[model samples]
Target: DQQVKQNSPSLSVQEGRISILNCDYTNSMFDYFLWYKKYPAEGPTFLISISSIKDKNEDGRFTVFLNKSAKHLSLHIVPSQPGDSAVYFCAASVIFSSGSARQLTFGSGTQLTVLP
Candidate 1:
């Protein structure tokens, strides 16, 4: 079963507009959330993270919001740019094992397009 899900498989937006991506989780025990941006050849989800301890986290043109009661989270990109176009992945944190690096469970991916 997919404990976490991104209901929308893709999203598209024009330049300078706001783009929103949504996700839902079935596991109430999951306390940490993240959003990762991926390009054609690189690895890493771009490492966007938010702790369940907080309701929201923001950085530059990106922001993430969480609702523990709803088991929902969303990522918003403002003034979407063509340069921002890429696949975005949603991941949740699992309990860490000793000496293990942080890992993520990725969504299939969402393709964001910023039309000029």
Candidate 2:
């Protein structure tokens, strides 16, 4: 079973507009979440993240929000630019009692396109 899922396979936004990407998870055990942006010839790069304890986390133009009660999270990019177009992956992980984190479970990525 896919614990994490990005229901929308793709999203399109105009340059300088806000783009929102959403994700859902079935596993409540997950305590941490992250978003990764991947380009055609490069590996997925860490974009933003949030802890289950916090509802929102922001870094520059990227913001991640988590709704623990709903098992959902979303990434919002403001003033979307062409360079921001890429596949965005949502990943979740659980932290063990030993303070170590387990391997992340990733959702199928959502392709984001920014039109000029």
Candidate 3:
């Protein structure tokens, strides 16, 4: 049972357009969510994140929104550029009482292609 799901395997966006990537989770215990972007050869880098207590978080051109009731979340990028093309992964975590301890579950990545 995959806890986190990204139904769309891929998405294509033109430059200067907005790109939206969707994700869903089945586990209600998940308290925090994060998005990671990976280039062709490099490791996945942290993009943006949102906690269950908050609905949205923004970092420059990237924004992450969480809908706890629907168990859904999304990553939005404005003015999408070709350089932004990469595989994005959605990760959910259940924070434990052990301070930094957490159980993380990752969704299959969705490939994003940005056209110039």
Number of the top-ranking candidate, with lDDT as the measure:
2
Candidate 1 lDDT, 1-116, residue by residue in tens = 88788877778899999999888888776677888888899875564789999999999989999988898899999988999888888888766566376556666668888899
Put down candidate 3 lDDT per residue, 1-116, tens digits, no spaces. 99999999999999999999999999999999999999988999989889899999999999999999999999999989999999999999997658778977999999999999
Worst 10 residues of 2 by lDDT: 94-103
Cα miss at 2, model 3 (Å)?
Answer: 0.4
- Model 2, residue 67: C-alpha shift (Å): 0.6
Please identify model 3 stretches exceeding 4 Å from their true place. Answer: 96-100
For 1-116, candidate 2 gives per-residue lDDT tens digits of: 99999999999999999999999999898989999999999999999999999999999999999999999999999989999999999999986657775779999999999999
Model 2 segments more than 4 A misplaced: 95-101
Model 2 clash pairs are: none
lDDT (Cα, 0-100) at 36 in candidate 2: 96
